[model samples]
Target chain A: MTLTVRLPGPAATVSGRGQRWAEARAGSLLALPAAVYFLVFWVVPFAGAVWLSFTDYELAGVPAWTGLDNYRRLLGDPGFWNSARVTALYTVASVVPSIVLALAIAVPLSRPGRVNGVLRALVMIPAAMPLVATSMVWSAIFADEGLANTLIGLVGIGPRPWLTDERLALWALVIMTTWKHLGLFVIILTAGLQGLPSGVFEAAAIDGAGPVRIFARITLPLLRRTLLFVLVIAVIGAMQSFVPAFLLTKGGPAGATEVLPLYLWATGFGFERMGYASAIAMVLLVAMLALSLVQFGVLRGGDDG
Target chain B: MTLLTRRRLLAAAALTTASGLLAACGGSEPEAAVPADGVPRGKLSVWLHQTKAYDAVFTKLLHSYVQEFGGVDVTPLYVPVDKLDAKLLTAFAGDAPPDLFKIGGWTIAGHARKGRLAPIIPKAMGVPDEKALVAQYDQNAISSLSYQGRLYGVPIDYTICCLYYRRDRFAEAGLDPDKPPATWEEVAEYSKRLTSADGRKVGLQWILGNPQWTLMQLLALVKGKGGGILSADAGTATLASDAGVEALRYYGSVGNAKLSNPLSGFGLFATGQAAMVVSGLFAMDLFPALNKQLVFGESFDIAPLPHWDGGQPVAPAYTWGWAVAEQSKLPYTAWHFIDYLQREDVAARQLKDASLLTPVKGWEKLPGADPKAMEIMAAAAPHADFGPRTPVWQEMAKALTDAGDAVAFGKKPPERAAADFDQAMRIAL
Candidate 1:
C-alpha cells in the first residue's frame, strides 16, 4: 500500500521559492542597522577588551603584551575577591526579593480593570525615571533624618546609619535597588499573567478550585518560561549594577558595597589600570554567561510536558 | 623672444606667492607664533574645575586676557572638581587635552611622570630661572607642583587644613572657643563634652569617603607623630609604623562616623551639629555661605591645625596649580596667560571674591585679606607638608582612605588597618 502525505497549509505558488528568497533578502536588509549596531557597539568593544586583558595598557601609553599577568594579579587581589563576593550577595539579595514582590503585585494587577491599569502605570514610574536621579532621591531617603528612618521609627526601630554603617550599607543599597527595579518586573510579570489561557482557570474553577488553588495549579505552571526570562534579566542587571553603590556608598564603610563594576571602574579610571579592568570585564562576562546557561537548564525543564 | 618669456615667468611666480599669502591669512586657525609686533597669537583652551565663586572671578580674568591680546582667542571649559581628573585623563588619552588646566598638586608627579605636563618656562612668566619662579610663591606651594626637581606648574589655589570651631558650641560645652583643641588628645577630650547624647552632635567629624582629604588629614596626624606615609627612599609603605598606628587610633578616638550629612563634616558644622572641622581658609567664607547665621569670628572661629601633644608640628597643605599640557602648541602663550592669571593683584582678587588663597609670597599681607585666617595659614606654611610625592599617588590615596575609614568606623583595629594599607600600597609602590 502506497500512502501520499499532504501538509496542512496552502499549496506552494509557482514563484514561492523566488518569493521566499526575496522576503529573506528584504528581512536581512531591514535588520542590517541592528546587526551593525550589535557589531559596532557590542562585538568590537568585547573583542577589544579581550585583547586588552592580556596587555599592560595604563590608559596613557601603548598597550604592551603581558600574557596572563592581569588575571594572575587579579587572582591574588583581595579587593577583587571582596567585590566579587559583594556582587554575588547584592545580586541574590536584590533579585530574589524583587522578583517575588513583583509576582505578588503583578497577580492582582493582571486583571482587566481601570484601577489596575492606573496602578500598573504608577508602578512603572520608578523604572521610567533616570537611574541617576532615582539614586540621588534614594540617597536622601537613606539619610539619618530621611523618609527611611521615619518609616522605621514608626516600628520603634532606633535610627540606623543606613548608608554610613558597614553592617547596613549593602542592605540599604539592596533595598534601594529592589525599589528601583520592582516596577519593571511587575509590568513584565503582569503581561505574563494576563497571557495565561483563561480556559485552564475556568476548568480549575469548575473543579471547585479557589483563587489560590487556581494560581498554584494553573497560573504558575503556565508562567514558568516568563519567570525564567525575568529571572535571567534581573540577575544580569543586578550583577552589572554600579551607579547606586558608587553614588551612595563609594564602595565604603570598609568595602561593604564594592560591587565588581564599581571596582572595575575604580581600577580602570582611578588607578589607570585599563588592562586589569578589562580582565575583570572578561571574567564578569564569562560568569554571567555560565549563570544564564545554568538558569536556563534548571528552569526550562519538562518543556515537552 | 627670451626677454618676453622671462617676464611672463616672473609674473606667474609673483601671482602664486600672492595667492599663497592670502590663503595663509584667511585660514580658520592661525599658526601659533609671535608676529614682528611681539604679540603672541594663538587660540587657547583652558580647563578649570568649577567653584561658583571662583568661576566668576576667573571668568572675568579670562575675558580680560582675550581683550588684552587682540590676536588671541580663549575657550574655557569648567568641569566639576570631582570629575575633572577623569575628564582630563580621558582628554589626554584621546590626544585632545586643553592647552591649560588646573591640576591638584598631588597629581603633578603622576601626570608629569607620564609625560603629560610641560615644564614651566620661567622666561614666559617674566622670571630669570626656576629659582626666580620659585621665589614668587611660598616654597612649599611651588615645590608641591614640581616633579624630579623640575617645576611643572604655578600654584594658583592653596590651602593648609586648619581647625574651624563654633564659639556657641564651645561655650555650650563650657570650653574656651578661643583656644580650639591644640592637640589631637585635646580634640578627643573636647569631643566628649561637645557630642550630644543622641550621637548626632560631635566634635571633629572626619570627612568620610574622600580619598584626598583622608590623605591630608592622616598625613598631618602621622607626620606629627614622626611617622610618614612612605619611607625616606619612597621604596616602602611606612603607614604601619608605631607613630602611624597611634595616629590612626587617635583618629578613631574622636568623632561619630555614623553622622549622616550630605556635606560630611562641613554640613554638620554649618548646621551646628559638629563643634569643629579641619578645613581650608575657604571654610571661613563657606560656613557663612552655607548658613547665613554663621558669622565668622563671632559665631565661629579658626585656629591653627593642632599638633600631636609630644610630637613635632606637621600641617598638611594641598594646592591646585595652573599647568600647560605637553601637547599644547602654544606653550609660551599658555604660560603667559597663566602668569597673567597668577598676578599678585589677581591673587588678591581671588582671595577677596573666591576666598581662594593663592600662596603668593607675603599673601598674608594681601590687601583686604582676613587677618586671622592669613596669620594661621602663614604660620602653617612653614611646617606645611604636602603628602608623599609618588607616581602612584592615586593608589596610595585610596589605600589611606580605606585605612582611615576602617579605623574611624571601628571596622578594624588601627594596627590591622595600617598593615592592610601598607599591603595595598605595596602593589603600587
Candidate 2:
C-alpha cells in the first residue's frame, strides 16, 4: 500500500543535497584544527609514552625492547613505592581539609552582599597569584623563624624545622598547598550554592527545621554533585602537584615530600631513565582515571538513592 | 582530491609530524668540525651558571675573545646554578646543547659516558697534545675532569674544602681566637662549647639537604676514617664498612640539627649563629658578601679541614669545568675560546676578580691569592680526593645525602644509616 504524496522535484532534491554537503564540509574544516591538535599533542605523546614504558629507553641511547622488565622493576623499586605512598598521603591530607574548609567558607560567602563580595575577592587573591610566587612566599613562611613558627610560638610551641624535618615537611607542604588552593574551591562551592534551588531550603525552614537541620537534610544533599566535582578536581590537583615540593624542598628532608610527579621528573630528567619514568606516568594516569570513575559512580549512585 | 581522501591525508600528515617530533628527541652525535686556522671563526653558544663575580670576569673574557677573534659571534646564556644541570640535560636530549658550557666535575663521567661531551682538542687549545695540557694545570684537578682516560674539559673555579671558623665565636666560647679545631674530636668539643642553650647558635653545622655539599662533607669524613664511598673499581658500595659507621657517628655527634639556614650553614656562620662551617674557597669571598659587618680576617678565618683524630688528613675538592658539547657544530671554535679563557694571565684575573682559583700550576704563587688560604690549599692539594668517578654520580650523591641527613637528624643510628646507604647504592649501582 505504497502511496506517493506530492514530492519535491529532482532539481530541488539535488540543491538540498549539495547544500547539506557544503555545510558538512564547512563543519569538518572548522574542526580540523582541534582534531589535528588532539592527535599531535595529546594522542601521539600518550601512545609514545605507553610504548616507551615497555622499552629500555634512556634519553642518550636507542630504545631497546624490554617487554615487562620496567613494570616488573616498579614492584621492588622502593623510591617508586615511597613516592606513591607520599602522593596518597599528600592527596588525602591536602584535599580533605581544602574541600571542607572551602565548603565552610563558601556557606557564609554564598549570601550576596558587598562585604561578602569583598571577602571573596580577598580569598581569591592567593589563587589569582601564580603558584610559583605563592610557593616562594610560603617557603619564607615555613622557615624556622618564619610566620608559621612565630604563630606556633605564640601558643608556647618552640620553633620547628618546618621544611627540614622529615616528620613535618610533608605536613608543611600540605599546609601551604591547602592555603594556596582553598580560595579557588571556595569560589567553586559558592557558585554551586548560588545555583542550587532556593525553594527547598525555604520549605525546610517553614516546616520548623532549624538552620543546622535544613543544611544537613537539604543543602548538603543538594550540593552533593558540586562537592563531588570539587573532590575529584582537588584530588587530581594534589596528585599532580609538583611545584611546592620541588621549589621548597626538592623532594628532601629524607624523601618525605617526594611525591609521584617529582619522583617521575627526577627519574626521567635527572637520572635520564625515560622508560621507567614513562611507566610511572602510565600508572599515575590509570590511578587518576580510576579515582575519577569511582567519584562519578559514588555521586551518581547517591543521586539514584 | 575527494573530501574524505583529503581528511585522511590531513590525519596522516598529522601522525607523521607527531612521530617525527617524538623521534627528534633521540639524540645524535654531531660531526666534529675541523679547524681551518688557530683563530676561531663561527657562531658559538655558551652556557654558564650565574655567579656575580665569575660572570663579571667571564663576560669580560667573552667580550675580549669576540673582539680578538673578530670572525666569531658569541652568545652566552647564564642559567641559575640550580637549574643549569636540568637545562643542560634537556638541551642534550633535544640535540640542541650549547657549543660550550660550564659544568660540574661530577657530571663529567655521566655526560662523557653518554657521548655528550667533545674530547679535548689540544691543537685548538694551542697545546701540542693532551699531555701538554695536563701539565699546564694541577694534575688532580685536571684528571678529575677526565673519563675513560680521555680529557673532556678544562678546570675552572677549582676549590678544595676547608674549615672556616668565626674568631668572635671562638673567643666567646673561652677558646683562643687564634687557634681552631684541628681534628674531629676538637671540633666536637668546640661545637659543644659554642652551641648555646637555646640551640639557635651552633658550631660545625653541616649543610643539610644539599646533595653535592652533603656528599662532599660526608666524603671527607668517610675517607678520613679509612673508608671509601665506592669500591676501588667503582662497581660496588663500600660505605657500610666499620670506618664509614664510625665517621658517621662522629658526624652525628657534632652539629645542632635545629639550626636552619637556606644557604647551608654558610648563612649561619656569616650571621654569627654558627661558629664553624665546612666550605670551599668561594666562601672566603662569600662570607663578607653575605654580611657587611663580617670582615674576613677579624671576624672569620679559615683553617685546614679537620680530620679524624688518628686518621690521615683528607681535603675533599670539587671542580667546575668548561666543556664543549659533542654535538657542537663549532667544536674547534669552542675549544679555542675555552683555551683563551683558561690562559694564565686570565686565570690570575679570575682569581683577583672572582676569587676563583683556576687550578693552574703555580696558582699558589699568583699575586692576588691570599697567602694563608693558598698555603692551606697547597698543603691539602696532595690529599684532595675528587670523590668517586662513576657514571651514576647523581644517584650516588642522593644516597649519600640521605645517609648523611639520617645521621645528622638523629633519625637513624650511624650503622643503620650507612647500611641503608649501601642498600640504596646496591640497587643504583
Candidate 3:
C-alpha cells in the first residue's frame, strides 16, 4: 500500500536465508519418519538375515557361529543342485512366455474403445485375484478328475496327473503362475503404450510407415524403459515363486517340483537345520542380487544410449 | 523473500507428504489384533495337513476350547501333508509357531531332538498312564515319538494299511467275493485276472506317491519272514538282510511282471480304474463314493498283513496325535481339552464323526463299526510293529522311501537299494 521498494539489504538478505534454511530443515524433518521406518523394517531385517546366514541357528535355541560350514555343505549337496535346476527352469518357463503373451495382448488392448475396455478388464481379473486362491483353484483343476482332465477326456486323451505326475507337475505350476502373472504384465505394458506420444506415430504414418513398422521402430524403442522395468520385476518374481509349487506339488512325485524356496523351507523347517536354511537363504539372496545387478547394468546402458 | 521460492518449497513438501501417504497405504495387512484382556497374549496357532474330516474334528475341538477358555484364541492352519515338517520348522524358527501342532510318527523324533517340541510331561499336558498309552498306540508310532526316554506327543490315531478292492469287480472276474488273496503269489494272480485291456482300467494299484507306506509294508513282510529292519537296539540297518532283500525284490517283481498297476496308483484307485489298491483306512470313506461295491479287507484275505513263509503276521501301523505346546500359556486349559478329548465317550464320538480309530482305551468297542475294522483291530492288536524311537526316524523314513521307490521303479536292484538304505540309516543315526 505504501509502495515501498524493498532493496536487497543485509537484514532482508539474512531473513531470506534464514527462512530458506528453516523450510529445508522442515522438509528433512518430514522425511525422517519414512527413513526411520525403512531402516527399522527393511535394512535391519536384512542385516539380521545376513548375520544369521553364518550361524548354526535353530529357531528354538541360541545360535552358534559356524564358518562357511553351511555353504560348504550346500556346494556338495545334490538337493541344492536339483533345486537350482528347478528354479531356473521355473523362471525361464514362466518369464519368457509371460512377457510374450502380455505384449501380444497389450499392444492390441492399448487402443481405446468399448471393446478394448471390456477385454482389458477381463484380462486383468486373474492378476486381481489372490495368488493363494488361484493356486487352490488350479490345484483342483489339475487333479486326476479335475475339469482339465475332464476336458481332455472329451478329446479321447486319457487322464494324466497334471499336479501329481513327476513329469507334468512342474509344467502345471509354470502354467498357473504364468496365468496369474500375465495380467500384471499386460497392465504395465498397456500403461507404457498409452503414455506414448501420438505425434511420433502420426509422423510415422505420414512417412508411409505401416502398423507393424510403426510398432517395431517407433513404439518399441520408446517403451524400452517400461520393458526393462517389467523384465527385472518378472525375473525377481519368478525366482521367489513359492505358493503355486508349494501348494500344488509340495515338491513331490519324487521332488520333481522342488524349487529353491521349497528346498530352503525343507532344510530349515523339515530337517530343523536352521543354520543350513540360513545358508540357503543367503545364497538365494546373493543370486537375486547378482540378477538385479545385471538388470541395473542393462538399464544404465539403455539410458546412456 | 520471494513467492517463487516459497511456492517451490511448498511443492517439495507436498510431494514428500504424498510419498509418505503412499508408503503407508502400500504396507501389508496389519498383524492380527492382540486380545484386550492381555492374558499373556500371543498367537496360538496349530498346523495340520489332514483335510475335511481330520480338519473338521480338530478345528471344532480347538474352537470349543477357545470359547470356553476365553483368554486365548486358537487358530487352525492347514498345510499339505508333504510340507508339514518344512512348514513347522520354518514357523518355529520364526518364533511364531502354532501353540499346538501335529506331526507324523516318523517326524516326532527329529522335532524332539531339535528341542523344538516343548516337553509334554513337565511343562505341557501330562498324559495319565504314559507307558500303557504308548503301548496302546502303534508301537512304531510311539517309538518314533520317543526321544532319549522323553515322550513328546500323544499318539492320536493309528493309520493301518489295508487292501481295498472292488467286490463287484472280483465277482465279475469270477473270484470269490468273500475271500481276498491270501499270499503275495495269490495277490499277483488275482490282480492279473482282474486286469482288463479296456482303455480305462488297470488291475491293482500300490501307493508309489508315498514311498514310505510301501517301505513299511515291505518291512512288515520281512519281519513276518523272521527278518527285521534294524538290530534289537536299532543300532544298525538290517534292510540288506536276506528277508529284506527278498521282500523288496518281490515288490519290484510285481511291478515288472505287470501284476500291479505301478503308474495307476492313487489316481487309478480314485477313478475306479484299478480293481485293487494297498491303501489306508482313512481313504475307505471315499472308496464307496468311487465305486459303491467297494469292499475292505486286511492286506491279504481279511487276515493281518501277509506273513512271510512260517513267521507270524506283522502289520505296520502309523499313528498321529495331539500335543500341548511347551510355550502355551494356557497349559491347564490345553490339558483340560486334551483330557476331555481322551474320554471314552468323547473319543468314540470323534472317531464316529471323523471316521477315525480312537487311541482311548476301550473306545474301539463303540457299536456299529464296520466288521472289517473289528477284524483289523483284532489282528493288529498283538503284533503291530513300529519304527525306532530315535530322532533319526524322519531321515530314516525318507531313506526307506527312496529305497522303496528305486525298487518299485526298477531304477536300482533291491539288494543294492537296501544297502544304500542301510548307509543312509547309518548316516542318519
Q: Identify the candidate with maximal DockQ.
A: 1
Pairwise TM-score winner, candidates 1 and 3: 1
Clashes of each: 0, 0, 7
Regions of model 2 farther than 4 Å from truth: A1-26, A302-305, B1-32
A-chain TM-score of every model:
0.90, 0.93, 0.90
**Candidate 1 clash pair list:** none
The digit string of per-residue lDDT tens for model 3 on B68-167 reads 6676566778987767766776666665566677767666666676666655542223445567556554455555566778777766666666666666
Which residue pairs in candidate 2 collide? Answer: none
Candidate 2 CAPRI-style tier: acceptable
Off by over 4 Å in 3: A1-24, A112-114, A143-159, A194-222, A296-300, A303-305, B1-103, B116-145, B198-200, B211-218, B221-271, B281-303, B307-313, B328-355, B358-372, B392-429
Cα lDDT for residue B256, candidate 2: 74
Interface RMSD of the predictions, in order shown?
1.4, 1.8, 4.9
Candidate with best TM-score: 2
lDDT values, one for every candidate: 0.89, 0.89, 0.70
The per-model DockQ list reads: 0.48, 0.43, 0.13
Give fnat for candidates 1, 2 and onward, in order. 0.59, 0.43, 0.20
Candidate 1: stretches off by over 4 Å: A1-31, A208-213, A302-305, B1-37
Rank by DockQ (best first): 1, 2, 3
- Model 1 chain B is weakest, by summed lDDT over 10 consecutive residues, at B29-38
